[model samples]
Target: MDVLVLIGRILFAALFLASAAGHLTRTKMMAGYAASKGVPAAVPATIGSGLLILVGGLSILLGIWADLGALLLVVFLVPTAVLMHGFWKESDPQTRQLEMVQFQKDLALAGAALVLLALIAHAGTDLGLTITGPVFDIN
Candidate 1:
């Protein structure tokens, strides 16, 4: 079971880790895309979002404050889905479909993040054989 949890954590954090790499590496390009999609303060937003996911990913991967990391992911996912992937605002059918998919994906990830948060809150993070035990003395 602990092994399963470790694997699941790695898999779940993979997407965010990859995304953070892209965000940090291609800041200007990503920021331009965000600006085109009408994001205010796109550059800083891109950097900040990258950092959020980075820290969030690291926190979860390291099993330190996984709850907080999950919350951070939720914060990033919800607004990003609403602000950047508002499919309803798209007119072109194909583009709308693409945006809708992205929107759905983001929401799905957010849902998963929320579930992780709930599970951690209820069960506590002291589950069996965690590679990295809970930190800061919180159970």
Candidate 2:
């Protein structure tokens, strides 16, 4: 069961880790895209989000501060979905459909982050854990 949990954490964190890599490696390109989407301070925002995603993904993967990791993901996912994938603002049918799909996917990821947060909260209560405690801390 613990092994399964570890695997789950890895799988969940993979997307964020990969995205962070992309964000950091393609800063100029991503920032340009964000600017086109009307994001203010696009370059800085991209860099910040990349760092947040990297930290959150690592925290979750290491089972350390998973709650904070989940919270960070929720923060990133919500705004990214709403601002970047605004299907409602699209007019082209094909583009609108694509954006809608991306929007749905982001929402789903956000939902997963929320669930992870809830699970972390429950574990904290049951194991008498604090924010500083590791998720698997049995002591």
Lowest summed lDDT window (length 10), candidate 2: 130-139
RMSD of each: 2.5, 3.8
lDDT of 2 by residue, 80-137 (tens): 9999999999999999999999999999999998887777756664433233544433
Instruction: List model 1 lDDT by residue over 16-72, tens digit each.
Output: 999999999999999999999999999999999999999888887878777778889
How many residue pairs collide in each prediction? 0, 0
Off by over 4 Å in 1: 129-139
lDDT values for all models: 0.85, 0.85
| TM-score, one value per model | 0.91, 0.89
Which residue pairs show backbone clashes in model 2? none
